[model samples]
Target: MARLTILLVVLVAAMATAFAPVPLSRTVSTTALNGQTRVEVKIGEGEPIESALRRFKREVNKSGHLMDLRHKRYFENSQDRKKRKIVQARIRKRLERMNARRMRQRRS
Candidate 1:
């Protein structure tokens, strides 16, 4: 009986871990040239788009924001600007995907 109880407990623990929800965070990368730099950010799952984006926008626009173009003159380079645009597009796409996922989850 003791062994059976232990086995049941172990099984439950394993199941919980296996089915646990995974929370993901945003990823950002940055590089600089002689006069300009580039930054990239990738968002992950876990929260609604509005909240995640609000956090992102706040951080990006903050005075010390790592990717701030004005603060980081090196990032003002044309190449760096292009990379920033690409990263921004990725962020928007991620938001759309997140919304779709949430809707599907709600339906189920």
Candidate 2:
């Protein structure tokens, strides 16, 4: 009788598990660079592969890993680095001024 009850319990548990809603599985992959940056994307069970690839590319671009890698590919001295930073700052300031002027003109 005990063996029969055990078998029944097992059978009920199996049925319950079989009927339970199964979650959609996702595939994830991560690429790490220098142990500092990682880009990851998950593809759902029904999601299109093209969409998943697009999402991965977007994530990579958004993370700036490619840019960082490019910048670090070559060695730059302190003076060169400082010059580059100054040029970037000047460009940023110019853009900000242009934007502010546009806003002021729009207000008029």
Candidate 3:
């Protein structure tokens, strides 16, 4: 009878845990200061601290946190923004041409 009670308790606990709603992903908390953004990662059970930190950094990078901070660091007038955009487009075109040339040379 005592063994039966213990077994029942164990099964109940297991069912409770199994039916609990699981979070899809760990929460990412961000803080910004002095034009830089910092990310805090909560390490999960059995997760290495270094691996968690690395993953957090990767997530931040993929989300453009650093790029956003960089763009926000200085005020840009409309003219300046336009000029920068033009320069970037030119540079992009130049790079594409160079890459195409390299590819053609490689094919020869």
Error of 2 at 87 (Å): 2.0
RMSD to truth, every model: 17.1, 11.3, 11.6
Which is the winner by TM-score between candidate 1 and candidate 3? 3
In model 1, state the lDDT of residue 108.
100
Candidate 2: lDDT over CA atoms? 0.80
How far is 14's C-alpha from truth in model 3 (Å)?
A: 30
Q: List per-prediction Cα lDDT, in the order shown.
A: 0.69, 0.80, 0.80
Clashes of each: 5, 0, 0
> lDDT tens digits, residues 30-99, model 1?
5556755445445675557787677666655553445464546653778877887899899999999999
Which RMSD does model 2 reach against the true structure? 11.3
Write model 2 residue lDDT over 1-108, tens digit each, in one string. 999999999889888855666545343445666777777676777889898888889878887878878878999889988998899899999999999999999999
Tell me the TM-score of model 2. 0.54
In candidate 2, where is summed lDDT lowest over 10 consecutive residues? 21-30
